[model samples]
Target: MAAILKDVMSPNPVSSNATDELTTVSKKMKEEDVGFIPVKEDDKYAGVVTDRDIVVNGLAKGSAENVQASDVMTENIVTGPPDMEVEEAARLMQEHQIKRLLVMEDKEVKGVATLGDLGVENAVETAGNVIHDVSKGNGNN
Candidate 1:
């Protein structure tokens, strides 16, 4: 049987509220040592705020102190089920040009699967392909 997302995903990722200030979320990211955070609205999964989102959308737009997670979060996020095959998850990440894949089950956020997670699962080649594909057209980054 193939490995599933649940077998390699980082479970119970720390989350932030849509109303949270960028400063607060940045602090949380520092504390957790993670660049990504799932954002919640009304206790429901709403979007995601990444370190890039903070710099590109939050800091680049206005005073960082006044910015909220929702102000910079990446909505229309890509998501997958925990039971999804790891290869499928890699394909999904590549297809979306995203480094992280939200794991959802029954309309609830369950975990997050990252390229590093896939690499650690012995899918290094697959992870590398995702990185290459995502970097394409991303431009000078």
Candidate 2:
């Protein structure tokens, strides 16, 4: 199977505005069962924020409710086109040690892809032997 951004990217991923507070972002992440959310500016991609970012940059600094998502968002995002293969994306992610990738198409944000979303569906090996064994009924080995 060819790896493409469309096959992995989470379409319509949960998002927050740049002006949103860190506390608010945390709530959204919990409510949506997501570890991160994209930051947007009037429908334009701005940056991205993860749970760790909120904790380290906000709560750790005692500024959760006051800190804006933009302030702590990861601006040096490694994005990809929708047509890119999933294997290539995985390689990039591994080299950078990133868990998620912002998907872009025609210079616009289309979705986001986390390591789990891509490999889990295409190759169980992408998740390691633990997941593979679990999914395969833990055969007597």
- Report RMSD (Å) for each prediction in the order shown: 3.0, 7.8
Winning candidate number (TM-score): 1
What shift in Å separates residue 32 of candidate 1 from its native position after superposition?
0.6
lDDT of 1 by residue, 40-132 (tens): 999899999988788878899867998899999988888999999988887777667778899999878899998778664555765666557
Candidate 2: residue pairs that collide: 3-85, 3-86, 4-86
Q: How does each model score on lDDT?
A: 0.84, 0.75
Separately for all candidates shown, the number of backbone clashes (residues 3 or more apart, or on different chains) is 0, 3
- Best candidate, lDDT-wise? 1
